[model samples]
Target chain A: MKTIEEINQKIKDGNAVVVTAAEMTRIVRETGAKEAAKEVDVVTTGTFGAMCSSGAFLNFGHSDPPIKMAHTYINGVEAYSGLAAVDAYLGATQPHRDPKIGIKYGGAHLLEDLVRGKEVELVAEAYGTDCYPLQNIHTHFKLEDLNQAIMINPRNSYQNYAAATNSSEETLYTYLGTLLPKMGNVTYSSAGELSPLLNDPYFKTMGLGTRIFLCGAQGYILGEGTQHNTEVERENGVPVGSAGTLMLKGDLKKMDPEYLRGATMPEYGPTLYVGAGVPIPILNEEIAQHTGISDQDIGCRIMDYGVPRRSRPAILETNYHQLRSGSVEIDGTKIQTSPMSSYRKALQVAEELKNWIEKGEFFLTRPVELIPSHGQTVKPLQIKRPSILVKDLKTKAIITATAQDNLSDVARLMVDNNINHLPVIDKEGKLMGIVTSWDIAQAVAKEVQELTHIMTKKVIVAMEDEPVEVIARRIDKYEISGVPIVDRDNLVKGMITAEDLSRLVCSRDDKRGESL
Target chain B: MKAWLNFSPEIVNKAVISNLMKNFDVSFNIMNANITPKGGKMLIEISGEEAQEGINYLENQGVHLTPVKRVVKKDNDKCVDCGACLSLCPVEAITIDEEWKVELDDQKCIGCGFCTSSCPTKAIKLAD
Candidate 1:
């Protein structure tokens, strides 16, 4: 078997045989792991997903009178100024403190903007100290001007995660995405077979200080992530759920902003989309075999986020193969699924890492400390949704069509609103009819019929205080897509549809055992 | 030709679309509209022999027109099938297929530029 040193030598000599986790799987399957292990020098793995515990430490060169900045805020996000002068750590999920700023543009944006070489406003406050006398300072610093900007993320590289679905009657706005009402859809966030941690589930050669591909540059594992747990169950070498994690650190100057970005989820706060890559040296047949695991072999539970809990009951157990297929069966019902992690980016990371290794621009390092097998009674975080009557859900400005309006115009209104339901009202704004997507489709197909002919005259409308569940049931039972919310006078005030119901669910859908 | 129609509050009650259909040989499809008492915007596509005349008539009839030369485009290579860009779509232009993979309908999109920012991978872009 080839050792890491041998592999490095091969890499240095441009004779190394490196393959992605995807390719490694195929090789091992063609020839047993034992046979493939002797031929393969490195198995590269990668993951690009939201990593909240991620942050970067920046050392802005000391200003005129070096302020031992007791407090620091970059773009209104509190940075860890507790360290030495001008040195601070900005956490990924740190909220934006500026009054006009949004959660979408916070600490992660600060990191990204720094990497992009944009000017960032820096604010600091320091109580007059003996050595440092400056009390307050405000200035702009760019990445090129900074002495050292390093990314020191404490936790990342979740081995596996759960599939997230919404089961509640109301729509949920969550990190998993908009979970449609009544088990409408499922969304999972995992790099799957291409994921670094999933490929080397047991962290064999991936330990402390293991050289890795971070963002666009080479990085290393600093230590076991803060929540690193090895007590979890494993099938072969892969963790069933979330298990081991890596404490990663990298140079911000060397990272790529394309692989590292900041995002703002509608209801959720700011988060960093991290692109991480790990290389597993083919030290032995076991390590090679571990990298050979395919998506079909990786197991993840489809957990319902409808229940507001850390660990919700699983709807079904599924593999990445089924997940990658884009749909999975739950209770015999087909549900659409989407990944939160960008497989395209993950694959790019793996390919980039492979190229670097081949070009001898990067090398692998043996782990100083490997993670233990994991354990956790972890649960997928449920996004809390207060089930209220239709009245509580504020409807946007009601856009209606006239009874005499042409069928094409009715369809046009629906298209503009990106809604299927269109309330046909009188000149005084009294609801006379409602047009559903089916009605619009019929209108489009037939090339005939006015709004009066296509609209459902016997409208299924809801009262303001009507429970959302009732509307949902009616929409389902009647097979109608939506119901217009009306007043006691029967004047249309707002409308709700199947699409509206789908936007009501909520959850974190974060990595680690909670969601795979 | 495609143009965004801005109708003022006073013109909201007019049957301009019907008038255009009856007067011109052009056939039109509404991509999106948000007509209200306060005024509204409409993204529409018109095609036929009288397309230019129809656009001129709409403009002369108090309907301001801004020809849309480009729309939002999505890159298949950069897309990860993540649903992050799904909820931000106003026109339901972005939809999840049976497999939960996100599929974008370029025609339905109003090019509002919301999905571009929401996209974590920066796969969606506005292009001519």
Candidate 2:
């Protein structure tokens, strides 16, 4: 058995053979694991995806006599300044709830700007003390100004991720990327076959203290990522869901901006696209076998993002082989599933990592503390309905007409409320039909007798529990003035008009504004 | 050989492109165009020996000529390749490859920047 010292010597002497996890797969397939392991000294694996739970800690040098910064804003984005006098943690998804810069820039962009050697406006407010009486400071900081800038991410790489599709009529803006309306398309974001955790399926190479390539810089594994759930169904010894994540730490100063990007998904907020690559030393034939796993063996379920729940329902179980083929079948409909993570970039990361190990610039580290192989699950962010629902948006004190009511009376009611449409209902408040001013005017011109004769019989209704956007699309698609909000039994609850939606726009802006 | 021109509604009925080809003895290849009722823009490659004269003739016909530069820029970070901008491209500048990722041909894209608004993620934008 060759020791790590022997591997180091071989690498130093330019004798060590390094292959990418992707290449090792083919090598192991062509020439059995025993031969592959003996020939290949290391296999590099990489992944690039949105890791929301990532952030960096910066220790800005003592500003003359610095006061303890209680709050901080880096380029108008709030950072966790609760650490010390000058140290702060800028979250990857911070100021996520708001504080938008030019429509969509946030903490991720601020971090990336810093990495690109751009000047960042730093503002801080602190309670005055005798030792350090300065309560506020407005300054500009470059990367060089920071004493130590460390990227200590709680989660970096996901083993696998769910592919997403929309079954609903409207488009879904999700972290999974935008899902097209009515199963128009599906989008998946995991690196899949090129992913780091996929190469080390059972955490054989990925564990605490494992040396890695973090955004083109040397980094190390810290611990289990926030929701590192290893307990998942295995198809060919590879977990089929988001499992076995890692907590990583690296010096942000040494990182490259090309591999580290900031992404903005509407409604979902800002996220960092962390490029991570891990080099796994081939200790045995088993290590080579694990790295050799194929794309067909790596499976991820295509989930429906249309469902309004924490755990979205999976529509189809698929593998990278089929997913990369560019389409998947959901409900017998041929839906095109596209990847969010750039495989072109992921491959480049792996190649660069392979070169690092070959040149003895990077080495492997045995785990100081390994993450549990099982017993973890993601506690989804409770989808709190702080915004208005369709029921809440309705004019509860609704005016209505019956089928027997004359067209003149219904038209008069519309003029009285300055409304365009009147909901026609039964005695039990169940919606029958809707009569607009146009319908009444046409009835008068045609000399029609009753409201049922001229009134539109086909009632297009909005559910009480549905979101406002869903109903808004209905109004736009049909060019209708308003829609009657109803319960499951066709019971007319209230009416939602374009005027109601306009009011929501003002209210949404109020809620989105940052607290002074 | 390359000319970028803008067409306002008043001058759109002038048939300046056809007039230039007939009068100046130049053939033109339309690389991109966003012709509509309100206003329009086009990027065309003028050919034949009299290409420069055709460009001058078209400009004299009240067509505003602009310089050829990057009119559309894609923020690769935000683009999910959902293909929302595919059908919106009047010049057929945006295409989905075998892997279903959206590829934008800047050469064929007119300065109209249709994909900017059509992009669900707002990944594509008109260069300032």
Candidate 3:
């Protein structure tokens, strides 16, 4: 087995054979992993996709009179300025303060403009201080004008990510790109086999301080990225969905605008499209095997965005081979597929990295510490506040009726309580059915005297401990205005009307308004 | 020539399109259509020897025709070849080439403007 030092010596001697991940796939397929490992010195991998967790740290040199800037804005988007004066962190997804400009232009756009060497307006605000008296500073600057502009992305290069599909009636505008209605199309954001993390599945050659191609500039892996999970299920040594991620840091001044672009998806805010590549030194046969994995071997889950929840239901499991083929079958319908990530740019990144290695301008580095292969998992945010339940609703007393009761009497009871619906109950207070004002009017028109003839036999209901959100969904789904809260024995505990639920919402909103 | 034909409520369900093809010696291609039994509009390109005769016949049937040229324009400089507009294109007018560059086929585009909105950079737009 060869070491990184041996690979570095080969590069310096101009004898190192560096092949792209795509080329390495063919080499290993023909010459086996062991032979390929001996033949290839390094396997360069690349991926270009919209990485939202990317940002830049800029030190816009201190203004005249040395203003202690507490608030800073680049272009129209606000940047985090909680640090020292003149320093701010501009996140890619941060939107402009103006609602009209929200998502259309953002920090990503400003970053792109900076890389393109375009002039951007810088605005800072602060309270007048003794040491730094200037309260406000408005200026213009270019990339070269900044004292230090560093790209420190908390997450980039996901190993694999879920493919998106919309199963709803209306089109969904999401960060995954536009998902057309009724599974109209599927969109996935990954370079698949050419992706950096997929080629080095277990983070073998990649870790803290590992050198990488970050948006046309040399960068280092800071550590495990935020939400980097290694506990995901794997197939053919690659994680099925989004698993491993890398925290990357690079000099923004050295980045190329072509490799770093700003994209504003309709309705979804702006995100930075990053071109990144990692060179995997083929030190052993295992590394070669991992690099040799093809698009067909890599699998990802197809998630339905129609669910409108954090854990969207998986429609099916699909591989990049099926996805890249322009169409995939979901629920027996042939659907057109599109890649949100750019494969062409990804290939360019790979080719560029290969050239760098061959020209001996870039070298492989051993990781100071390996990224954790286990114990890391995605943990959802948990709030300690109590959720509103149907039982918790201080609903009005549940009015009841029996089959023997006269329809006019029940109608009178509804009129007296100013209620539209009344739950029909049995002798033991168990709910039998329900009747609404419309049913009473129908009974009058049909000349029906008995409540049995007018009352509905099937009643939609909610459980006592069920979350109010669930009951609200049922009310919306069934086109009803209310539901009877029932126990396990079908005993009517209370009634939750649309009015009651709306009041609850207003109260919660009032509390929020107070805090605001 | 490319022309948009508007069918009124009275003539919407009539066999005007079929009759035009059967009676005329001209060749026509239906580029786009949004029709119901009540009324609708259709974009079609008509050509061949009796094209003028077919236009006269359509006019006689109270069909309003508006000559259409290019419907959509794509600014190549602003496009990133991201393929966001590929799947949303109903007519398959937009495609990713072997190099993954986005290619727009004007001949196939019905000017639906589906790709215009999906483009993040606003690179593609419908002609006014």
Specify the highest-lDDT model's number. Answer: 3
Docking class of 1: incorrect
Ranking by DockQ: 3, 1, 2
The reply for model 1, stretches above 4 Å from the true place, is A169-171, A180-184, A233-237, A329-335, A374-516, B18-29, B46-61, B65-69, B73-83, B86-105, B108-117, B120-128
Which one wins on DockQ? 3
Using lDDT as the measure, what is the rank order of every candidate, best first? 3, 1, 2
Q: Indicate whether candidate 2 or candidate 3 has the larger TM-score.
A: 3
> Candidate 2: which stretches are off by over 4 Å?
A1-6, A95-103, A329-335, A380-407, A412-461, A464-483, A486-516, B1-103, B106-128
Clashes of each: 28, 0, 0
**Model 1 lDDT per residue over A37-100, tens place:** 8889888898888888899888888777879988898888889788888888899888777757
Give the range of the ten consecutive residues with the poorest summed lDDT in model 3 chain A. Answer: A381-390
Evaluate candidate 2 and give its CAPRI docking class based on DockQ. Answer: incorrect
TM-score of each model, in listed order? 0.72, 0.76, 0.81
Error of 3 at A455 (Å): 21
Better of 1 and 3 by DockQ: 3
Candidate 3 lDDT, A1-516, residue by residue in tens: 999999999999999999999998889899999999999999999988889999999999876799888889888889999888888999999999889889889989889999999999888999978888999989899999999999999999988999999987768899888999999999998898899989988988889989999999999999889999999999999999989999999999999988998889888889998999998999999999999999999998999997666788899898998898888998788888889888988999999999999999999999999888899999988756667888888989878888789877898999999999899999999998899999999989989898877788878888887778878877997899988889989999978889998999999999988998
Clashing residue pairs in candidate 3, if any? Answer: none
Candidate 3's chain A scores what TM-score? 0.82
